[model samples]
Target chain A: AQSVTQPDIHITVSEGASLELRCNYSYGATPYLFWYVQSPGQGLQLLLKYFSGDTLVQGIKGFEAEFKRSQSSFNLRKPSVHWSDAAEYFCAVVVSAGKSTFGDGTTLTVKP
Target chain B: GAGVSQSPRYKVAKRGQDVALRCDPISGHVSLFWYQQALGQGPEFLTYFQNEAQLDKSGLPSDRFFAERPEGSVSTLKIQRTQQEDSAVYLCASSSGLAGGTHTSTDTQYFGPGTRLTVL
Candidate 1:
């Protein structure tokens, strides 16, 4: 079974500061990884994903993630943070059957 | 034209009551999925449907949970005799195709606003 782990429960960053969210996964083979963000009272929105080819994948909202096969990690990163970036972020791993296993989630708070 | 849409944005049901959540996927989407998001937690996979066939349902927590996509376009998730623990936001997402193959899972999954179910 594929499982994801997000080490951070909550992270606070000042506006305009760089941000990085750590994510690790346990899978028997190469895994499909994804990052999603959820705002209050709303469903999750995709931040980025990594499947094959390039190790670095870019997504919406100025976010990006790099897939590291050796580390079994796909961490999300952003050059600068904004207030609107404050939300709950999730790291997920998809199995061959398309079943997605998600981490507990990390809540991001952008401080002014 | 629109993205995924779910009905009854909020549902309140007493314990032991039955509840049904509806999801209308984007037209032409071949894959639909159901997920459960508990308070302060990431969304958990509940099930997946490829067209009218339910290809995977290993994530459903219990037998009380049921889902159907009869026509392959719209899907419904039903919980029988809901328990207090069943209270959570039920989210629906749609993708372009089934898992595996050259198709990348990184493709965006359009999600609905979700149905917040409260089992008191």
Candidate 2:
């Protein structure tokens, strides 16, 4: 079965520190990858996506993700962490036009 | 420009009761999707619609769940005989369908605030 995995359930980082969230997937073929962030009581917001070109994709709010086909991984990265960045991050993959598979999600907590 | 919107931000339903959630996508958005999000979990695909046509509903958990986009602009998700396990946040998203070929997944999906459902 196709599945997306976010190994870390929760992560903590000091404010202004670099951050990385890992995401891996098991699929028959290389699928479109996406990163999303959700704050309390807010809907999921698209951070970045990797379709075909560019292994590294930049997204809103100073976020970027690198898609490694050989590793079947699409990891998200940020240069610095902010208190407002404390939220849930999800990784999703879609093989076709619809029906996206999502990881369980990782919650980030920014510390002072 | 306004973003996607969902009605009844919160719904409390008794077990066995039926409920319907509404979603209004951005104007001219041709692709719409529904997802179910449990507490602390990522959103799971529930269904997808292109224009008024429901292209894929294989992600729907059961027959009790149904979704429709009659005019290709607004959509509704209905649950029959709700159960305690059915409690979750329902999210609706929309994307411009201008991506040609199988590149539909390349479009960015704009999500609504979502409707939190509580089953009593």
lDDT tens digits, residues A3-64, model 2? 99999999999999999999999998768899999988888899998888899999999999
- Worst lDDT run of 10 residues, candidate 1 chain A, spans A93-102
Candidate 2 docking band: medium
lDDT for model 2 comes to 0.92
Candidate 1 residue runs with Cα over 4 Å from true position: B99-106
Report the CAPRI category for model 1.
medium
lDDT of 1 by residue, A61-102 (tens): 999999998999999999999999999999999765556789
For candidate 2, list the clashing residue pairs, or say none: none
Chain A TM-score (model 1): 0.97
Q: Score the docking of each candidate (DockQ).
A: 0.62, 0.66
Candidate 2 chain B: worst-modelled 10 consecutive residues by lDDT: B97-106
Number of the top-ranking candidate, with DockQ as the measure? 2
